[model samples]
Structures are given as C-alpha cells and as structure tokens.
Target: MGIKAFLSEPLARYIVAQQHEWIAASREVQEKWRTGLVQKAMNTQFGKDHFFKDIHSYVDFKSAVPVSDYEDLKGYISKIKEGEENILWPGKPLYFAKTSGTTSGTKYIPISKDSISNHINSARNAILTYIAETGKAQFLDNKLIFLSGSPVLTETGGVLTGRLSGISNHHVPAYLRANQLPSYETNCIEDWETKLDKIIDETIDQPMSLISGIPPWVQMYFDRIIARTGKKIKDVFPEFSLFIYGGVNFEPYRAKLFESIGKPIDSIELYPASEGFFAYQDSQDEEGLLLLLDTGIFYEFIPTENFFDENPKRLSIGEVEIGKNYAMIINNNAGLWGYSLGDTIRFVSTNPYRVLVTGRIKHFISAFGEHVIGEEIEKALRYGMERHPEVEVVEFTVAPMVAPEQGGLPYHEWLVEFATLPNNMEQFVQDVDRRLTELNVYYDDLIKGSILRQLVLKPLRKNSFIDYMRASGKLGGQNKVPRLSNDRKIADELTKINQ
Candidate 1:
C-alpha cells in the first residue's frame, strides 16, 4: 500500500470543518443541539407527553423525562414495529436493530433515517478524525475491512431487524464496496464458521489496510488468516496499519493481537452499539474515547453506586465528575429519551472530554459486598498476562460461585480459553488473583476477612464460548462472552462442555 493522499484529504478537511465550531465550544454546541432536537420532535407522542416544548433547559429536560430503559419505552417501540407514526419519532423507523440481548430476551431498537444518518456520520467522523490527527493517508490506499455481519436486511412486522454491522454494510456505497474486502456473498453466510472460512478465502490475498470489528471475532479472522498462510499478520497485509475495535475492551486482546501481528500498529477504539455511536478514541496518546458531545445523542450519567435505585440522580455532562463510574443515559434524534444504554463508563478527562468503558450494568459479579466489573477483570487479566508473556488468553469470562455446591466458600470463578496456555497453572492463578486483590479494595477485604475465598481459575475446553454462542444462535457479529456474571448461568453452561 502506498499514498492515497488524494482520497482522504477532502473528507478529512470536511470533517475538521464540521467539527471546528463544536470542538471549540462543546458546551454551547451541546446546549443548542438539545434545544434543536427537542423542538423539532416536540409534536411526537413522547415529546407531547413529556412536555418537550417546556424543556427550555437541561434541568427542565431531566425533570420532564425520567431515566429509562428498553422496558420503559417498549410500548412506543411495539407501536413503531407495527408501522405506527409519531410514536417515538415522527414516523416509522427504516429498520429495527435486534439486539444480542443481555440477560433480557431480544430487544428491537428503532433506527430512523435521521438516527441512522447520525450513526453513519459519527462513524465516518471517527475514521476521518484519526486521519487528520495522524496525517497518514497511505493506509487509505488499500481496502478497509469491516469483519461485520451480513449486508442482507431482514424485514419483520413492517420493520427490518438485523445486526448493526450488517445494517452498516447495506449502506456502503457501491464505489467503496470495491475497496471493502469480504464480498457481499461471503458476509451473508449464516453460520459464523462458514462465513469466517469464506472471509479468509476472499480477503487473504487482498491488499488490506484497515480492519474494524469487535475484538474477538477479528482475532478469530486473524488466526485463520495466519494459520492458513503460515505468516505473521504484518506479512499477510504488508500495509496493515489500523485496527479499529468496538463492543468490547481491547486490553484483554492486546498481547495476543501484538503476538499475532508481530509488530505494533495504530489501534483505535470505538463505542458503537445499536442505540448510537457514542465515542471514539480521538488521540492514541490517551487510551480513552473522547466523548462525542455534538453527535445527535444528548448524554446523561447516573452514578453506578446508585444505578439500581428506583430514582438514581442523573448528572449532565458538565455535572459528571472524573473517575466516577456512571451508567450512561441518552436523549437522541432516534427518540431514545433519557434511555440508559446499560453500559457504564468512567471519565478520564473533562476538557474535550474522554472516558473509559468500565463494564456492562447487567454483567457484573457482586454475590457478596464485593462488586467486580469488566474493567477490574481486564486489569487483573492484563496483570497476569504481562507476568506470563509465554501464555496468551484467547478469551475469558467470570461468574459468581455463590454456594457450597461448587466449593465451601463463595468466590469468583474465571473460565479462560487460552491461545497459548500458561506453563504453570499455579503461576497463572496467583498472577490473576494477586492483581484483583490490588485493584479492588472490597475484594481484598473479602478475601482477607475470610468472607470469600481466593478466586478460582478453570481452563475452558477449546472453542467452548464459540460453541455456546453458536448453539444459542449468537455466534458472530457483536455477540461476546459476558466477562462477569451475577450468577452461575454461564459458568454452568461452559462447565458442562468441560465435563
């Protein structure tokens, strides 16, 4: 791959031009955005009931619309699916993104034309922003691969339902599709194994520069490419430079990816889901994603400590303090008003704000007083992995062992599937357990007080999580192993395979 200077310069300039006023005066921009969005949709059903016209300020908006979730807005969503008009948005959505449901069953999120435009723009801006920051347009010369779901859209109840990545695939311009690897036919393959095999067959010899997808699946793609070619990823794609990942933290996969690629390249993180494109890593100097304040979505933060409260205090962007975990709430052009996305984030910066995704609200283990999250588990795993450089954890998940049936004392149970197993299991156990003790005070106290035993480690059988997801019909595209669970559901399921 060589210079694609002409290709990126115009778009890069356009992005910067659009961002200029917003980046300079984010607070002012945000205030204006809220007003415009509220006023424009004031006649919609939700707006009428919530008194959107009366919401002249953030305080008024907060007072009018309470923090909500899928259940709170399901009535409006149901009407939308039935082709109703002026329910949440002004009219029916162009599509319904069937979420890879958490603990709850399937959720159908509306994707209106306006909302989808916003999603596309935000994602576009992220890549352009990086191009502007790094001044490396050569990477754009080659194909940009999105190891996403199929491009085929499925219609249901007068609205389409599909994975977000697949939905995105449908929107790729015909011109760009020439540069986008993995042809339409390969991407549409229903079974992940077959699809992955096809992707390898199609893109292995192609000039790939940028790769974007959720971390685990992308890793799987890389593994296959490497195994078949018998070469490092860097050699496989000589110009490969950027790997854009979202839906999960990249820290856990960092070491293994580096090992596979044989060298480091620029890695960008995105926070995109069916609901919205929330944030992207604006600067690789700092690891956190810069909050996309001027995107179509208006954000609110509920302190994680009070996240389960019937009425948790919600804080505006300005009101959010640094280093505090908050469950994210949003009011967006999509008609998701005061809706919590069920993800938690911790702020790292306020000026030109940036934040780290800490965990999922539904995916955590707090069997006793010790509340452990994905962030802690990642940190613990990173610590262990760093110590044991020879070993590589391909994937892992944790669940609470809360009863005497499993063991005498209740403790966290980790199921790790190794790419390269640790030479010593005892060393692996000590490394992860020691890190968790250092990272979480409550966990340390529980272990010290004998209220909880040291965390247990279990090696998962090969392809265990993959097999599980496949059986559950969630094998690919944004479906991931829940890093931590409140109960032993995932633990029991995986344990059966090992047995």
Candidate 2:
C-alpha cells in the first residue's frame, strides 16, 4: 500500500484537508515573515519595545528573530505563576510540557490545544505507518506497553491544574485503550519513583507485544522485568514485534539490547519528541523518512557551517540539500516561531525527504580547540568498532577533563562498556585514539604533545547506561539520558562506578 493508503482513511483525509489549510496559512505567514512583520511584532511584545525599534536593525530579521534563550523567558514563566496571560502564546495555552533547562531548573513550554491535537494525530499516523511497514498491524491485537512520563498536574486550589498525559491518554483508540496498562495518569502516585514501581508491577505479568518509550527507560523496564521474573526480555515477551524509542541516540545501547532481546535490529528505532511526533524508520534498510507534519509546523533548515557566520542563509523544506548538516528551526502552530531546537541533522534524500539526525549542536567536545562535534565522535567510534572485530561497545560517552594528574593537558576520557573486557585495554584505547587522530588533524597534534595528555578508557558493565538512567530518575517515560554531558560533574559521576 502507498503511504496514504497506510493511514486510516478518515484520518488520512482529515490530515490532507488540514494540510491544504496549513499550506495556505504558511504562505500567508511566510509572506509576512519575509517582510519582517512577525519579528517586529514579537520584538515589540517580548522586548520592552526599545530594542528592535526597526526590523532592519537586526540582520536576517525575516528568517531570524533576536535569539531568546531559556533565561529570556523567565518573566513569562513568572506571569504563569501569577495566573496571568503569558507572552509565549497568542492565546491561552492548553498545557505546558515541562522540559529540562541548562541553567533554569525546569522550563514549562506552552502547547496550545490545537498543537496538542496535532501532536496526537501525528503520533497516531506514525504508528499506523510503522505497522504497515512491519506488517505488525495484524499482531497488534495484543497489549502494548508504553513507557512514558507520568502525567504531571499543577496543583491549584487543592485540585490538579493540568493533567498533561491524561488528556492525551483519553484520545487513544478504544480497542487498544483497554489493553494499555495504568499510565502515569491513572496512578495516584505523584512522585516518579512510586509511579515507576507501579508501571513495573503492572507490566510484569502482562502479555505485552509492543514497547514504546525513550531508550534508557525501556532498558530500565527490561532490567526490572529480568530482575523480577529471572527471564530475559525474549523470554518474557516472546511475541514482541516492536521496540519503539526516541529522545536520544540508540547506537551505544544497540549491542547489549539486541543480545538481551534476541530481536532483529529492525525491531528498534522510533523518533518522536514532545514538540511533535516527527519521524520513524519506514523500512529496515531506509533511514527515517521525515513525513512532514506539514499540518503541524513549517520547517526551516539553517546550514551548520552558517550558524556561527555573520551572514547565514536558511533553506525551506524544498530548498534543503542532502548530506549537509543543518540545524532545525521550526515555525510551529504551537506558538514557537523560528525557534532553534539546538539539534543538528542532515537530509539523506528529498523526494520523500529522508533525514538522519547527527547530534545535538551544544553537545560537543573541543578540549584541544579542534571543535569536535558529535557527528565526528560517532564516525570515529563506528570506524574504530568496525576495525576491531573482537570488541562491541555497549555504552560510551566522551568528556574533556583537565589532566593535571596525567601530565596537565586536557584529555578525552572514554567510558566504554564492552561485550568482553579487552585483555589489553591500553591497546584498545590507543587504537581508538589513533582512529580519532586520523579523522581530525588537530586531534593528532593534541595527542602527540601540545594540548592533550593521553586517551584513557574506563570499562563498564553491559547495562551501564540503563543503570545510569535509572539512578538519575530519568529512566522510563519522556526523560532521556544525554549521550554527552557538557558539564564535568555529570560525566565524572557517570565514570565513578567504572573507575
């Protein structure tokens, strides 16, 4: 069946019809956008009106507005606390998705009712398409396990203010709804700790066919299941057909996960985020085709090389080139216009518009001033792994650390979990270092003498990432473990056990 036929007929028609409306709306917005009207309005509203007096004052005013980091929205957040209308949205937002902030404790991003509805529709469509591709729709009559965040409600006047996940849960299909175990919503437990226990208890004996969530949480659930039942995931759910995951890269956990489940590689990888359900792996071999939720948002790509340059160019959906890294900026109906999500991605093709996510823009190491990005690290790691047939990396993260103890130059410390601990751990580390040096000239210079001390390796258990996530209270649900920690403390804490 074609992509359209794969969707539920009524839903397909609704989405297509909505797409037409969006296209018209987008054209109107883009016209105004090109004229810098949106930026003018936003600046007047957001700033005290003194800044951005004229649109031409800021470069790229049409495609770019003055950047608003998480700190810039504090006043709006305070307004939310005071029960006043916030400037983040055009109208009263239906709900807020609490996301982590670097400096701010937590950021409550507004999601309008319309945006929530769009998210729901996009997610459902992704699932349907996935089922069609895998031919697993036939087997989905059995129960599905969703490892998601518990619905958190803001307490107001002795009552819950907004039950976020509960609203989404209500929209689940009637047939499949009953089969779903008690989520963070139905459980009265407010603490995530208690909610996780409840989720584990509910699924221990259930016949779950499909598992979905951020990878670390799913791994934690699998760990808990094994601990409780003394059986591997394959033993617990022999009929399992799907392992849907998103929110973080799954490459590091692949070997251990596949070994435990005894499932084919195709059983894993699904990409969905809080903003919207973006994409999913269409076929076993094909990298994810980003089915533009054209109805949800208008997409824009800013080339990675241009991000730091004074005069940068942006590409609309049609204009983007394949194999070039770009940062995603979206003008979504959710009230975020020209917002940079800090993720770097590359298009694989444009016909159906397939893309591969490279990594986070902010998550990179440059101890020796080489400006090594996550893409480079992934490439280097993969190359090293391919060369060494005996070793399989289970979990790995690289961090730049001061090396006073090891000769006083900054160094990249690798915390690696291998299938088998290498007899010559130093040799393995040196080999990886050599591979990385070959990839970048600066790395070679740093390694030889100037800036870097030495490549260090700390071996970990196969399930170390899973353990780390569980320990951090991020396991299960929406929260994901970051592959690279810019801060040294988190990275140090992660390496402690291995050391």
Candidate 3:
C-alpha cells in the first residue's frame, strides 16, 4: 500500500476524535439547526396558509411542521417524472437513489454532488476504522463485490434519472474501481424479477472478496447464483471475506446466508439511507459505531418511547443517553431539516457514540426479526385458506414456535383464523409456503431444506389481530399488531395455541 493509503487508519481515528470534540464544543451548530427549522416553519405553505401568522406564533412549531410521508412529495414527482430537477437541492443532482417507500412502490431520492462526496468520505472512514480495529490494512488489496443497485438511467428527453450506485461506480477510487464487474444495465428497471436474473448471471463466475447490499436482496442474489451455476456459493466464491449489509436487520436471514455461503460471521453493518450516509461498523469485531458526520449533517435523537408522546425531548449527539433506544432525526444539507429517518437505534457507548440498531420503531413485528409484516402475513394467510373462491382473511396473528422434533429450529406459526376454511388444509399450508418463498428467499430456503419445516397455518376466529391489539391496550388510534415476537411468554403461548 502507498504511504497515503497506509496512513488512512490513523487519520480516520484522528477525524473521529475531532468530531467528538466538535460535538462537545459547538453550541452554534445546534442553535443554527433550530434557527433553520424556525425559518422552514415560517416559509412552509402549510404553516403560513393554515396554522399561524408567522413561524414563531405557531404552537410547537417543530411539531407543527407536519410529518411528511411518501405521498407528501407527489408535487415534486412531476418534475422528476420527466427526469428533471425540481425541489430540495441547488442545481441538478448527480442522480437519484431509487428507494421503496411504504406506499410509493419505487421513488427516486435525489443524491447531490455534495451528498455523493459525503458518502465517499463516510465509506472511506468506515474502511479505515475497520483497518485500524483489525490491523488488517493488507486486506484492502482484495477485490470488493458490491451487490449494488443497477446502474441504468431512465432516459426522459435524453436525460438520465436513476440511482446513485451507478453514478458512484464512475467516481470511486481508481484502484478499488478497477476491480468491479460489469453493470446490469439491461435489467436495471424497478422490476425485481428482471434485476434478480441479471444479478445471478453476473455474479456466478466472478471472484468476490467482499459483498455488500440489503440482506433480502443479497439472499435472493445468492439463491439465483446457486440455481444458475448449479454449484453452492462456497464452490464459487470461497474467498469471500466480508458481508456488508444495511437497510434492514440481518438476523432473520443470517442463518440461511451462513448455510449457503458456508462462511463465518465476517460481516459489517452500515446505517445509510437515500437521504444520507450516516453510521457504519467501525470495527470488524464490534457491532457498529455511529461516527457522527459533523461536517455533513446535524444529528438529533428522540427516545423511541417518546415518538408520539405529547412532549418529546430531542437529544443532540453530546446529550444522548447510552443503552436507550432513540429514533434518528437529521438536518441534512439537501434541504431536509429535522427529518426523521424512521430508524430506531440505541447507544452502546457515549464517548465515541457506538450504537446498535434496534429495528424501525414503526417497522417491527412484536420487536422480533422474523421477516413478517402486518400486510404481508395477513395476505398470505387469507390467500392460503381459500376454501371457496370468495374466502377472505378477516384477521391473523403470527406467533413463533421452537419445535425440537421439527428440525430443532424456530418457525413462524400463523394462527390465521380465516373468514372461511379451505377445503384442503394441506393445500392451504403449501400455498402459504409458496407466497412466503416468493416474498423472501431466506424464508423459502428455511422451509425447503434448512433447519425449519413448513410454516404452520392454524385457523383462528376472525378479529385475531384486533383482539390482540385491544388486549395490549393499543385499541385504535395508530396502533398496529406486532408482526414478529421475541418475548418468550408470548411466543410460548402462541406456540401452544398452534399445537
């Protein structure tokens, strides 16, 4: 390695220390962020036309700024609908990072040139930290296989509008950039089917030293790789060292991925989003550390229990409490001020801000890592128990079961009390398996030949989820059923009911 490359680890440590000092000393950053929020509230169309005369008069101006969902950005969509720059950033952004919103199927979030530079700097810091922790700077020479988003750009009036992965591919370090495989341009559309096939074909013969992507997509890619190559992943990419993943929890897919790759837990978790690149695994051995990008964005942490509570206190990096889960709020340069990234994490240490991700406060299934969401499991059960063509799902609750006799592994037992029972119960169970397999390849692998057997579909009375919700005292408002459960008592009770 060159002297510059060799010094990267020490430099990274120095930068991290400097950031901690900045957070400690800078009261101006916090004041400036709050001032920016006041300015946004004053200028906001919602606040001016509806709420109050001026931003200062608005009651709880921070709270008054309506929490925006995907639908809220529909006006801006028209500009990018024609692949043109519209709102939020100065000048045309480099490209959009295609992300799946809760309601919007696929939306392109802008990635400005400044944002790209921040991402690069954050990524480099993460690498350097890893090297510093492991004393493995020589490993940097190994090839990295990014199971990244496709590089294809949509042509609207001869203009390119797509994800930043492609744009970044053209801009990474020359030494590292030289090792990448060809892009999946032809299969780069939003359709998962086409993209999956292309990923499989491309990765089959390539020598991959490190891999990175979301866990579900990575599992799907490997499944296709195995199917197309007719060889196990170990037989192909035996040299694979690191598995870098983010966007979702890795626990659900962890066992299956290890089985397929026949690799150890040599993995790294990153906490990045379309909005910004935030934290990454500082050490190869430690869980993850939230290295505040002090120059890139201002940070805030709201305790998870205070998400919807009347008076929520926002904690800055310096004031954040350790061992308590907090939702991330960011003041990003791309015009997002005090924006919630919808991720929940807890501080592991305060000095360096090491943290562990504890799932999305809104995106958990009873705080467990089983890949089931409310809509997904409900639809699966309803479709599974189809006695008559009109058979529909009225309610359902997915409970976890650990059966030693049944392959000695934990499984999701669907207490699916349907509106109508299916004529053939076996067929219903099989249909549930098929649907789940189609949705998540990891679940499919477990059901097929791994430790777990098929998912148990138990018919319950209608209003199961509702009854459960009511019993939990989360009857109406915005409360929903827990999709996954880790509480042993709940899991055991549900498992007993299934049995």
Candidate 4:
C-alpha cells in the first residue's frame, strides 16, 4: 500500500468504530437530533406557524407538522427564494440543490451549514466501512473519478445553487484532490458528450483505481474506453477495483457491465439525495444498506400500503419492522419537517436498521390492479437474464397497454432497449413473464382470470432511451428515465422515438 492507503487503514478503523457506537444507540441518536432540529427552528416562520414551541415529543411533533411534499411547502420555499430569512429554517440556507420534478417543474432543496456534513460524512463512512471490513485501502492511492454533474454552480437568491453532486465537488478534501481525475475544466463542460470526450482524453493513460456514477452512464464511459483502446476496462486500468453507484438499481445493468470489464469487481451502493444522505452499503456480506440514524435527520415510516391514506399510520425507528415497505418521512436539520421523500424503502434488517430502496412511491403500475413494483420488475428481469446469459439489456420501461392499437385485451407493454438482442426472444419474454407472475400474486391472478393478457415485449432500437432523454433536453448530469410509469406519457414518447 502507498503512504495514503497505509494512513487511511487506521483512520478507516476508527471511523467504523464510531459508526458502530451510533448504530447501537440509533434511537437515542435520532431523538437527540429531533430535539435539536425542533429547538433550532422553533423561532422560524414555519416553526412558529406549526406551533413548534408546543412540540415536546414525537407525538407532538407529528401532530404539529403534517406531512408535506414540495407543493405543500412551495409557499415557504418561494419566500426563501426571494431572500427571506428564517422562513423555514433559521437564517438563509447556504445553498439550494436544484432538481427536476414531475408535477412541479423544478425544485430547490436547501442545504444548511449544519446538514451539509450529513451528506459528506455518510459517503465518506461508507467507503471507510468497506476498507475496515475488507482491509482494502490501496485503491485510495490511485486516481478516483466520480462521473458527475458539472462542478459549476449559479446563484439563486444569494445562495450558490446546483445539482447535489456538483455542489459536492467544491468540498473534495485536499488529500484526495491530487488523485481525483477528469480535470475541473472538463467537468464544467455543459454538453455531456463533449465532457465525456474530454474526460477520456485526460484519463485514458492515468493509473485509475476507482470510478463512480450511475450505472448506465458508467456503462457508456466503459463502452467509450473500450472503443478507444480496443481493450476491456480491467485490461486498461488493472487497478480499477471499486465502483460506487447510486440513483438506481444495479441488477439490470450488471451482466453487460461485468462483460465489458472482463471481470467482477467490488461495488458500494449509496442512497444520497438533495434532501439528505439516507443510507450506504456498509458491509459486502449484508444484503441492504445501513441507514444513517445518527445523521442530523429524524426519520419516520408509513407502511406503503397505507401511504395513500389521508391519515397514514406513522412509525418511529423503534416501530419499523423487517421486510415491510414504508414511505419514508424526514425532519432534517436543514428545516424540512414532515417532508415526504417520495421514495419507498423496505427494511431488510432491523438490528442495524438496513433498508432496500423499493421504488418511487408514485412510480408503480396499478392500472389493472396488479400493482407491480420496480423491485419486482427489476428482479424478474434479472431472473430472465440469468436464465438467458446470452441476452444483454440496455434499458427498459413498463406501462399498461389499456388499448392496443392492434385491437386485443389490455396487457402490460415492456419497451426494452437491448445491448445485444436475445436469439430466442419468445423464450426470454416467457421467462420474464413467468418470474413476474410468481413475484406479484395479483398479476398472476389477473393473467389466470383472463382479466389481463400476458405481457408483450417491444424491442427498441439501441440508444432508444438515450434518444428519448436527449429529446426531452435531459441528456445527462443526474437525469435519467424512470423505469416504469402508471401512465402512457413516457411510454408513448418512447414509442415515438422508436418510430
């Protein structure tokens, strides 16, 4: 190991030990954070309006602050954007993490001085946890590239504003600065293809050991690298050993990614968002990510089944059970109280409070009462791909075909873009359909009762998703196509692109 790796080993162990202390005292830590956040924001407009002064316990807090999404908080957010002080939190926010929204056009989530550490430290601890467990710190000595949004930021109401990843760029510790790849100038390029080309120019010959990004974009980088050198990724960068990824499930892209690399490698899954860094994969042996309870955030859970209910049952950390899906609600130090994160997660292990991100709360398909989820579809696709090792998928989305243009019973339509087409497409579809039926009982009942026809897979041209995203002006920089939809909006647009 190099000098940095040798030094990090001891530091990594210390960090892991600190993490354990918090994990063991999860409830106490969360309670402390909740009290601190409430007290700090009590004098703010939102806190005063919501009677934060009267809130003393979890029950009081819950009853005082009703659950709120972006729309519900728009009034306060607008005041903050207009240079108001203490509208939501005390004083003005340090920065606003901007993101695209579905119903709302754009969202600006605040990041305060107090809450910024939560984002940075959670990510740092995840890697340190790996190093502590596996005793693998040598990778830190070499080049590490995080394929991310632009480091360039603009100002909004006197606050620096940009994508969360971009804002994080400003905070890379001095120790890692020398080892980080893809020059800042390249990162500042607005166009993704141009930026990627510049990145290839800068790093093609570097001794890179780690690469991090969403899987699809990373796959694109791998494809470009192979095209340039005519060598597998591992062959080009023998030291490249760790992949850090987030924002989507990695299962569907696994086969093609490993095939391109010519070997398997270690990976760390992260659950970072504009609102907070919620969890990170702390153990390679563990099936889910370790939720960061001690972060400057208080978490609540509502069973996903009752999530749509007007008065959903909310549970604190002590009340959450294993293997049940829950819509997460959070009150963070940044002053977002009773905020619905919109992502649904299932607790895979309760001892250390580990969770698997199930899917978006709004991104499921219940058009026919089958109620298929993103996890089920992803697993079923992985199952089919495993059975047919010859097939490689690029991207896919599912939507209900309520009225087939060809005139037939309503069914689910799968728009799939393939990296390599399956030789026996019919068998591939059958395998996927069978697995999905087994995974979702309601879907099986619908098929058996003839209420819905078997799923139909439409093979899309290569780069179909890319074309669609590009056409929508969301070609890169933390933007991605949703995996499934309840409506035909995305599906119809994809069909148009393929046409």
- Which of the predicted structures, 1 or 3, would earn the higher lDDT when compared with the native? 1
Task: Give lDDT per model, in order.
Answer: 0.85, 0.62, 0.59, 0.92
Query: Model 1: per-residue lDDT, tens digit, 1-499?
Result: 3435567777887887777667777777777778888987899999999998888878798789988889889888887877788888877788888785654578888888888976787777788888888887776667888988776887867888888888988887664667888888888888889999988888888888899988889888888888898999999998899999998888888888888998889988889989988888888687588888887887889999999898789887778898899999988887898898989999998877889999998787888978888899999998888888888877889987878674588888899998888888898888899899998999999999999898888998778888888877888887888888888888898898788
Taking every candidate in turn, the Cα RMSD to the unseen true structure, in Å, is 1.8, 4.9, 13.0, 0.9
| Tens-digit per-residue lDDT, 1-499, candidate 2 | 4333344455545544554464455444444443443443353244233233444522444424533445655676456545555254444566666666666777666666657766676667666655544554533556677666555466432223443444466567765676677653545465555676778777767777777776655665666677778888877887677777766667655655676676673454555554555565555667755545354565667888787666467667667788888988765555565667778888887656777788887787775576667777767766666565556665678787765464666778777767656566677667777778887787787778666766677777666765676677654456554555555766777766555
Higher TM-score: candidate 2 or 4? 4
- Candidate 4, 1-499: lDDT as tens digits: 7998998988998998898899899989989988998899999999999998999999998899999999999899999899999988999999999999999889999999988999988888888899999999999999999999998989888888999999998888889989998889899998888888899999989999999999899998999999999999999999999999999998899989999999889999999999999999999998999999988999999999999998999999999999899999999988898999999999999889999999989999999898899989998999989899988998999999998889878999999999988889999999999999999999999999998888999999988988898788887778888889999999999999888
- Candidate 4 residue runs with Cα over 4 Å from true position: none
Candidate 3, residues 307-359, lDDT tens digits: the string is: 87766777766678777878887755554555677777788876556787665
For candidate 3, the lDDT comes to 0.59
Q: Which regions of candidate 2 fall more than 4 Å away from where they truly are?
A: 1-64, 155-167, 183-197, 291-293, 309-312, 387-394, 418-420, 448-450, 461-475, 495-499
- Which residue pairs clash within candidate 3? 365-483, 365-484, 417-460
Worst 10 residues of 3 by lDDT: 473-482
TM-score of each: 0.96, 0.81, 0.62, 0.99
Candidate 3 clash figure, as a count: 3
Model 2 poorest 10 in a row by lDDT: 43-52
Model 3, residue 93: what's the lDDT? Answer: 54
**Local error of candidate 2 at 364, Å?**
0.7
